[model samples]
Target chain A: MDSMIQINNLKKTYSNGFNALKGININIEKGKFFGLLGPNGAGKTTTIGILTGLVNLTSGNVLIDGYDVIKDYKITRRMIGLSPQEINLDVFFTIKELLTFQGGYFGLSLSESKKRVEKLLYDLGLEDKVNAKARELSGGMKRRVQIAKALVHDPELIILDEPTAGVDIELRHLLWNSLKEMNIKQNKTLLLTTHYIEEAEALCDEVAIIDDGKIIAQGSPKELIKADGESYINITVNKINENILSDYNIDINENIIKITSKNPEKDIPNIINILSESNIAVRNLNVKTASLEDVFLKLTGKNIIDD
Target chain B: MINTPFLTLIYREVLRFIVLYKQTIMPGIISSGLYLVIFGHALGSRIGSINNIDYIHFIIPGLTMMAVINQSYANSSSSIMQAKYLKFIEDYLVAPVSGFELSMSFIIGAIFRGVINGILIILTCWMLTDFNVHNYSLSLFFLIITSCVFGAIGVIIGIISKSWDQVGVFGTFVFMPLSMLGGVFWSVDMLPKGWQFITILNPLYWMINGLRYSMIGISEIPIMFSIIISIIFAIIFTIIASVMFSRGYRIKS
Candidate 1:
C-alpha cells in the first residue's frame, strides 16, 4: 500500500535554537491506524504541527499524497483533518455551528456543509447536542464535538493528537470504538499520538516509538511483541531469598528474580520452592506478556513516559 | 468554493459577536449611553452651541462613530487576540481555510458590530437630543465604512499582540487617547492653527468630521476630504491587516 504521508528527512528547529524534530522520516500507510507514540515534548506534537502547517519546518520535506506541505498546502490540508491536543473549541458556537464552520473552512458549499455537519454529528454521537453551545456540553461531549468538527471535511487522513488526554475510562472506550469503526468501515488512515499505551496497542495497527526528536522503533503491535523473542519468568516463592532461586538457572535482575524461559509452566515449580523454603518474602508476581511498553523500555532503557 | 470558505469564516465570526451579545455589543451601547447622558446633558448646557448647533447636537456623530469604532475594533481584535493568547487559533491553523478568508471574517465581524453600535448611538442621540440626521445617506456611509476601517486596524492589533495585556495597552494608551482627542467631545475648527494641522493627521478626526458633517450640515474639514481620508485609511488598514494575516505573523510560530 502506498504511504498516505511520507516524510523525507524532515527537521524542525524553534526560534530559541531548540531542535524539535531532528532529521525525522516516517511512512504511514493508507487506511491504517498508525500511532506516533511518544511522551509529551518528544517531538510528536512538533512533527504533527509541521505536518498540519501550524508549525513551520526548519528543513526537509513532508508529502501528503505526494503533495509537498508548503508548496501544495491547499490540497494537502484539504485531505487532512487535525484535532489538536488542547480542547479549544469556540465556547459560544453550537455543536452544529462548529461542524458547519469546519466544513466551510474547507470551502464546502452551505448545503453540502450542512449535510456534512449532520453526518458528522450523527456518526460522532453528538446529534443530541447539535444546537447546544460548546461550553454547555460535558467534557466528553465537547471532545466528541471537536472530533466531529475535524471529520466535517470528510478527510481521508485524520490526525488526533492526544485525543483522550483528559477523558475518563468509559468515555475513552466510547471514543476509541468510534475511531476504530471509522478506520475499519470507512478505510480512513488515522495518526494517533497518545500517551495511553494499552489504548494505542488496541487501536493502532502499527506504532512508531519516537524519543528525543527521533524514531527509535516502528512496526505492527504484534510484530513488535514477537520480534522481542525473549520472555522473562518473574517468580515469587513462598519464602524470601534471591540466592536460592539462582540455582535453577535463574538470573536475578534487581527487584525481582528472573530466568529466561520459553515456557513458564515448566519453570514455575522449581523457582517457587526456593522462595517457599528460604522465605524471601513473596509479595506478588505474574508472567505478563511483552507489550509496547516493554519494547520502549528495552529500546530506550527508560519508560516511554519518561523519555 | 472560495466564497464558501470565506462565507463560512465570516458567518462564524458574526455568530461569535452576536452570540456573546452581553460581552460584545451591550458594553458598547451602555458605555456610549453613559457618555451621552453625562457629557451630552452636562457639557451641552455649559458649552452651549458650536457653529449654530447645540454642543449635544454637534458631538453626537463623533461620539456615535467613536463608540462604533471602539466596540467594533475591540470585538474583533480582542476576540482573535484572546484566541491567540489562549492558543485556540490552532483550530483554524489546522483547517483548510486560506489566510484571506480568515482575515475577511475578522474584518467583517468588526464591521458588523461597528455598524450596529453606530445605529444604536444615532438612535439614542435622536431620542436624547432630537438631533435629526440632516444627510441620512452620508451618515450611513460614514458610519459603516469608518467602522470597517478601524475594525481592520483591530485585526492587525490582534495579529501583533503577544499577550492579552498588550491588548489593554493598545486600548487604554493608544485608542482611548486618540478617540477622546480625536474630537469625540469637541470640534477640530475650535483648535489653534498648529493643533488644527495635527488634528488633520488623525484618521478618526476625518472620520468623525465626515459623520459630524452628515448629521449637522457642518464640518471642520470639507466633506470630500473626510470621505477620501476614511476610504484611504480603510484601504491602508485593510492592507496592513491582510498582510499580517497572510504572513501568519506572530501566530504560525
Candidate 2:
C-alpha cells in the first residue's frame, strides 16, 4: 500500500538549543488508523507541527501524498487536514462561519464551502449551535468545531493532535464514533497523537510509542504487547505468608502477590492452587497480559500518563 | 476555477471587522467628531487663517486625513495582532496562502477601514460645517495612497509586536504623537524655524499636506512633492511589510 505520509529523518532543533525531534521517521499507510502515542513533551506535537508547517524542520524531508511539504506546499497542504492540539480559532466567528471560512482557505468556492459547512455542522452535532459564537460554545463544542473546521476541506488524510484532551467521557465517546466513522466508513487515513492509552488501544490499528524524542516502539497494540513476551498473575490474599513464597519467584506487597510468567494459561491455575493450599483466603485473582502501557514501561521505563 | 486563498483571506479579514463594527468603526467616528468639535471651535478663532483658508477649513482636511491614518493603522495592527494573540494565524499559515497573499490581505483590509473612516469624517464635516472638497479625484487619490502607506506600516507593526501592550504603546507613543505633531491642529509655518524643520521630517506631515492639497488646493509643501513623497512612502512601507511577511517574523515557528 502506498503511504499517505512519509517522514524521512525529520529533525527539529529550537532556538533555545532544545532538540525537540531527533531524526524521527514514520510512514503512515493509506486509509489506516495510525496512532502516535507519547507522554508530554515527547516530540509528538513537534512532529505534527513540522508536518503541518507550523514548525520548521531543521533537517530532513516530509512528504504527504508524494509531495514535499516545502517544495510542493500547495498540493501537500490541500491533502491533509489538521486538528491542532491548541484551540486556535477565532472566538468571534460563528460555528458555521468558521467552517465555511476554513473551507474557503483551502480554495473551496463560496457555494461549495457553504454546502460542506452545512453537512459538517449536522454531522458533528453542531446544527443547533451553527449561529453561536465560538467563545459561547462549551469546551467539547469548541473541540467539535475544530474537527468540523478540519474536515470542511475534505482532505485525504486527517491528523488529530490530542483531539480528546480535556473532553468528558460522553464527548470523548462521541468523538471516537465520529472518528471511527471517518476512518472505517469513509476510508479516510488518520494519524492521531494522544496520551490516552485506551484510545490508542481501542481505535488505532497501528501504534507508535515515542519517548524522549524517539520512537521507542511501533506495532499493533496486541502485537506490541505479545512481542514484549511477559504476562503476570496477581493474587490478593487475606494474609501473606513468607514460607509459602519460598519456592516461587513472587513479589509480596503487603497481602498481594504478583508473579510473572511466560504463559498465563499455565501459570494462573498453578498460582491459584498454591494460594488455596496455603489456607490464604483468595480475595481477588487477576491474570494480566502485557498491554501497550506495559510495553511502554518496558521500553521507556516510564508510565504513559505522567503529570 | 477555485478562488485563490488570498481572496478568502481578504474576505475573512474584512468580514471580521464588519462583524465587530461597533468596536472597529464606531470609536474612530466618535473620536474624529470630538476632534472636529473641540479643536475646530477652540482654535478656529485664535488662529484665523492658514494660507488663506479658515482654521476650521484648514483643519478639516487634517482631521479627515488623521482619521484615515489612525484607522488604517489600527485596523491591520489589531486584526493581525489579534490573530497572533489568539493563535488563529496558524489557520492561514497552514493553508496554501503565500506570504504575499497574507500580507496583502491585511493591507487591503486596513485600507478599506481607513477609506471608510475617511468618507464618514468627510461627510460629517460637510454636514456640520462649511467644508468643501475642491478636487474629488485628487482627494480620492490622496486618501487611498495615504491609507495604503499607513496600512503597510500597520502590517509591519502587527508582525513585530508580541503583546497587545506593545501595540498599545505604538499607538500611544509613536502614532498618536506623530499625528498630532504632523500639523493636525496648526500649520508648519506657524512654528519656529527649527520646529518647522523638525516637523517636515515627520512622514504624516507630508501625508496631511498631500490630503490638504487634494481637498483645498493648499499645502505647506509643493503638491507634486507631497504626492511623490506619499507614493514613495507607501512603496517603502509595503516593501518592509512584504519582507517581514516573507521572513515569517513572529508568525511561523
Candidate 3:
C-alpha cells in the first residue's frame, strides 16, 4: 500500500522547553481515513502543526506524497488542506470571498475558484451565507465555512483538527456524512485528530491512541477491542452450583452469575450446557461486548475527557 | 513575474484597506485639510512667507509627507497586529507562500496607501492654494521610498509585538515626537544653532525636506543628499523586514 503521509522520529521542543512530540512515528496509507486519538495536550495539535508546516519541528522528518515537508514545502503544502482547530477566520470578508482567496493561495484562477466555491457552498449547506461576512454566522456556520475553505482547493489529503469539537449534534452528523462521502466517493485521504473516540470508531479505518507524547496502541477499532478489551456474560439462575462453573472466571452475588471471557460467543453455550446438566434453571441471560471506549480506557487508564 | 499566491496576498492586503476606506483613507485627508485651514490660512497672514514662497505653500510638502508616513505605518502595522490578535495569521502561515512574497505584499500594500494619501493631500493643496509640484517625478519618488521605510518598520513592530500596547508604543512615543520636531511647520533654520543641529539628525526631517524640494524647489539641505538618505533608510528597513520574515521571527514556533 502506498502511504500518503509518513512521519518518522518526529520531535518538537517548543521555545519554553516543552516537549510536545517525542520521536513518534505514524504512517497513513493513500485514501485511508486515519484517526489520531489522545487526551488534551498529548501532542495532537503539535503533530498536525508539523505536518502542515505551521510549527517547525525540532528534529525528524515528514513526507507528504513522498516529498519532504520542509525541503519541498510548495509541493507538499499544495497537496494538503488543513481545517485547523481554531476558528481563525478573517471575519471581514464574505464566505465566498474568503474561500476564493483560499483557492487563489493554492494557485487557482478566479473562474476555477468561483466554480469550486459555489459547489462547496452548496455541499456544506452554506449557500445562503455566500454574501455574509464570517463574523455574522453562527458557530456551526463558521465551522462549515472552515471546512469549505479547506475543500475549495481540492487537495488530496485533508487534515481536520478537532473539526467537531464544539459543534452541535446536527452539525456533527452533517459533517460526518460529508466527510464519509468525500473519503469514499472522492477517494480523498483524511487524517483526523478528535477527542471523540466514537467518532474515530465510526469513521476511521485504523486509529492510533497517543498519551504523554507516545503512541501506546494502534490498530483497527475492532482489532484493538478484541486484543485488549474484555466481554462479560451475566446469567441469573433460580439456583447456582459453584462446582460446575469453577472452570471460568466467575463472580457470584446471590442468584446472579457473572462470567468474564475474551470470546463471549464460544463461552456462553458451554456455560449454558453445564448449567442444564446440573439441573440449574436459567431465568435471564445478558451478554456485553467491548467497545472502542472500553479499549481506550483499559490502555490509557483515563477517559478521553480527562485532562 | 509574480506568482499567483504572492499576487493574491497583495490583493487581499490592498482590499482590506480599501474596504475600510472611511477609517483608513479619509482620516489622513481630513486631518491634512484641517492643518491647511488652521496653520496655512489662519496663521499665514501673521507669519507671511518663508524662503520666497507663500506660508501656506511652504507647509504643503511637510503635511503631505506626514500623511504618507502615518498612513503607511498604520496600514501595515495595524493590519498585521490585528491578524495576530485575531489568530487569522494562521491562514497565511499554512499557505503555500514564500516569506519574500509575503513581506513584499505587505510592503507594497502599505506603499499604495501612503502614495494615495500623499497624492490626495497634494491635490488638496492645489485646490485650496496655488501650489504646483516643481518636480513630479522626484515628489513621487520621495512618497514611495518614505512609505517603504515606514512600512517595513511597521511589519517589524507587528511581528515582535506581544500586545496592542507594544504596537501603540512605537506610534505614540517614537513616531509622534520625531514627526512633530521634524520641521513640519517651521523651517529648521528658524531655530537656534543647537536646535538646528538636533532637527537635522531626524530622519523625518530629510524626508520632509526631500518632498519640499521636489514640490516647491526649496530645501535646507542638498536634494541629492536627501535622496541618498531616503534610499539608504529604505534599503536597510526592507532588508531587515525581509530577513525577519524569512527567519519566521516571533511568528513560527
Stretches of candidate 3 exceeding 4 Å from the true structure: none
For residue A59, what is the lDDT in candidate 1? 93
Tell me the tens digit of each residue's lDDT in model 1 across B1-253. Answer: 2566667778878888888888877777787778888888986798888888888887788778878888878977888976786566887776666776677788888888888888877887787777688899998899878878878888988888778788779888887888877898887777898988887777778888899989889987789999988998888888887777766788886
In model 2, the fraction of reference contacts reproduced equals 0.80
Better of 1 and 3 by DockQ: 3
Estimate the overall C-alpha local distance difference test score of candidate 3.
0.90
Ranking by TM-score: 3, 2, 1
Give interface RMSD, every candidate, in order.
1.7, 1.2, 0.9
Best of the two (1, 3) by TM-score = 3
Worst 10 residues of 3 chain A by lDDT: A298-307
Candidate 3 matches the true fold with a TM-score of 0.96
Residue A21 alpha-carbon offset, candidate 2, angstroms: 0.7
Ranking by DockQ: 3, 2, 1
Residue-level lDDT tens digits of model 1 in A205-230: 99988887989888998787677534
In order, the B-chain TM-scores come to 0.94, 0.95, 0.97
Reference-based lDDT, residue A272, model 1:
66
Q: Model 3: per-residue lDDT, tens digit, B1-253?
A: 5477788888988998999999989999899999999999999878999998889999999899889998999888988888888787878877887777777788999999999999988998899888789999999999999999999898888888998899899999998888889988989978999999999899999999999999999999999999999999998988888887776788888
What is every candidate's C-alpha DockQ against the true complex, given to 2 decimals? Answer: 0.53, 0.66, 0.80
lDDT of 3 by residue, A155-243 (tens): 99999999998999989999999999999999999999998888998899999998888888989888998899889899999997788
